[model samples]
Target: MLSILKDFLLNLFFILIPIFIVPIWIEEKNIPKHIKRHLLTVCFALVIILCMTIPVDADREFISDLRQIPLWLGSLYKGAATSMFLCLVTIGYRSLFGGTGFFVTVIISLFIMVIGIALEKKFLALSSKHRVLLATALCTFSGILSIVLAQTFHRIPLSSDISLAYLSVQPICMLITCSLKEMIYKNIALRKRIIRAEKMEAVSHLAASISHEIRNPLTAARGFMQLLEQHHLSPEKRKQYVRIAIEELDRAEAIITDYLTFAKPAPESIEKLNVKTEIERVIDLLRPLANMNSVEVKTTLAPFTIIGEREKFRQCLLNIMKNAIEAMPNGGVLQIYVSIEKQHVLIRITDTGIGMTKEQIERLGEPYFTTKGIKGTGLGMMVVYRIIESMNGTIHIKSEIHKGTEVSIYLPLSSNLHDLTNEEKKLFMAL
Candidate 1:
């Protein structure tokens, strides 16, 4: 019995290595849940086949023959059943009770596994996690039950066959369980992120509306004040009043412009354009600013075309580059790289400027979130984020304090213009 147990553990270990390790190491980024499930099933199936085919010798023929069956197979089935049950239970519990208790979940998992075994068919109704837990409970129960039956009967009627059946259910259950758990967690996280984004967008729109209404009158008032300053009045009084009016008008205008940029961003008129050409134009526009700060701008542009609003995209790139330039007022390298991967274009902007802390980066897309004092309104990156999102693109930022920052943008290849009604196109153009 000791030798059998040792062999069973060793076999189980070997079986799991392929199922877990290969997927993680070889296809790290895109490990599909279905592939994982099938892998578990195949691994356990092999173990069962081996057990039935292998020979064993001992005093108790039935026990010895049963020992020859692969333990991993039982483990797989139990795990799969338990996982499926757990998923179903979690969904129902979350809906009805708003949560699930750990112990209650386990109990439900065990019940589902047993039912699946008795039915001898994979229950597709339950989720992967519940299936896994059920499979685990079923296999464990079967193994213990087998031993009890043998001791009571004083013989093994079909110990080997029963053990093989148990083995088949466990591992599959475990695999399904793990997959379900991951899926659930991911979905929850995604939903939370989306909600936060929508809230930020709403705030930005409000800000923009207020800015627009305020700015029109402010512009007219400033023009009238300038006309008054030009009149032949006393030199000292004219200079002082003109200074106050001009300064206040400039300040008010700045506030309104920043607010509008954040709130009511214009939609992009997306077109297929060369990314390199766009970058060059922005570079020319920002060169004087970079020169003023004594910063060196470097670019390695790959020829890639993307369907996007050219002006809005330029503004996004300009905002990021301007931030980089400001960070290194003493001078540093602003490196830009444009590349293409399968079905997507990648833009990476790196700065050798003072980088931000983790906390700062985490709050980057939030409205009015800024590290630059007085001069910064904190809406530059927010605007950039809105533009990128509207284009159906993704952005990732990595930064280490004092080391520097890298921002990567991934845009899909589909440049096909979204179909728009004439009114919609006109509205978009006006914006």
Candidate 2:
């Protein structure tokens, strides 16, 4: 009795462990479906063979083992093809034992295979609780059939203790294993759904950000082209308009390329950026727009070094200064100043324009909330907020209606000064 119970428990572990653990590996998208299916079939076949190799009682002419559990599970959960293969394996293995019970094993396996194949569709369609009940019922029926056939066909004597134990334990083990498999399947399906939803959300955000960024340069280019259409414009002015238009188009292309870097497999390169050089580049690009709005550009820039992506840094500066110029349609002073404050680089951009209300300022970075109304998507400041945060920086805006607005950005100073040449270090010190 002790030995039979030990064998039964060992058999139970074989079926249950893999059912719980293998789903995690097989659920990965990288594994092809046919490969996953083959892997599962091989796993269950091994479990079936292990149960058969160690029979419950080596002395009995008619051996009993819990091999049918995995066979039935594979069939009901998978389909008829797996059922046919498992039935063949069970019969073939039992034939090697050379006993009257081998024929009985053949009959029972075939009967269960037929039943499993027939009811597989309904078994899968059932709820988890119902599936467990049905599987347990089927296992119990197979146990009863084995006992009746053994007695009627060959009058083989059976131990009452072993029979009772098999009847009770087989159904219970089937119930436990089936319930666990159903639970794992439910969780895996839910996880896949959540991952898909998160991917969709990321794509939506990227689309909105790219559209907003590209529109800025395109809008500026359109403005320059409009200026060039004036028939009475001087030759020099037309040439200047065409140059600014070409530069704006190039800026638009660069913005598209920058956004695409997020999709690449490799990490983007980060470098030490000179604040003065990048800021001046942005100012030079936006100079045409500033002149159109009659806004005077004044800068007090220093060559402070910071760590970030250079294009993103330039995009941030361009967005802020463009907004400042647009704020003052009737002409005003756009002042940009850079200095060191504590352990950070401070960039202050103040505009003498129609400033914003406290309410407007609070809503600055909210998506699609704009004082420019139809002309703005409100994503520019949103991008600014994201980039600054990614660089471990902070931005503060102080504005009052009819007064002026001051935008202050604080970025941590790059600490790798050893990379700079002596001349560069001297230039930094002089500034």
Specify the highest-TM-score model's number.
2
lDDT of 1 at 312: 78
Q: Please count the clashing residue pairs in each candidate, in the order shown.
A: 58, 0
- In candidate 1, clashing pairs total 58
Whole-model alpha-carbon lDDT for candidate 2: 0.83
What lDDT score is found at residue 194 in candidate 2?
100
Model 1 per-residue lDDT tens digits across residues 193-256: 9989998988677667556645755775676576675757677866676777776577666556
Model 1: ten consecutive residues of lowest lDDT:
61-70
* For every candidate, C-alpha RMSD to the true structure in Å: 13.9, 10.3
User: Could you give candidate 2's per-residue lDDT for residues 1-431 as a string of tens digits?
Assistant: 78778889999999987898788877765678898887888888888888889767543457778888998898888789898888888888888886777877899889878988898798889888998898889898998888888777667456677777788888888988988988898899999899999889977976877787789889999999998879999999999999989988987775565454434433257899989999999999999999999999999988888999888788789889989999999999999999877658899999999999999999887555668875664567866776787788999999988878999999998865566557546655665
lDDT of 1 at 422: 60
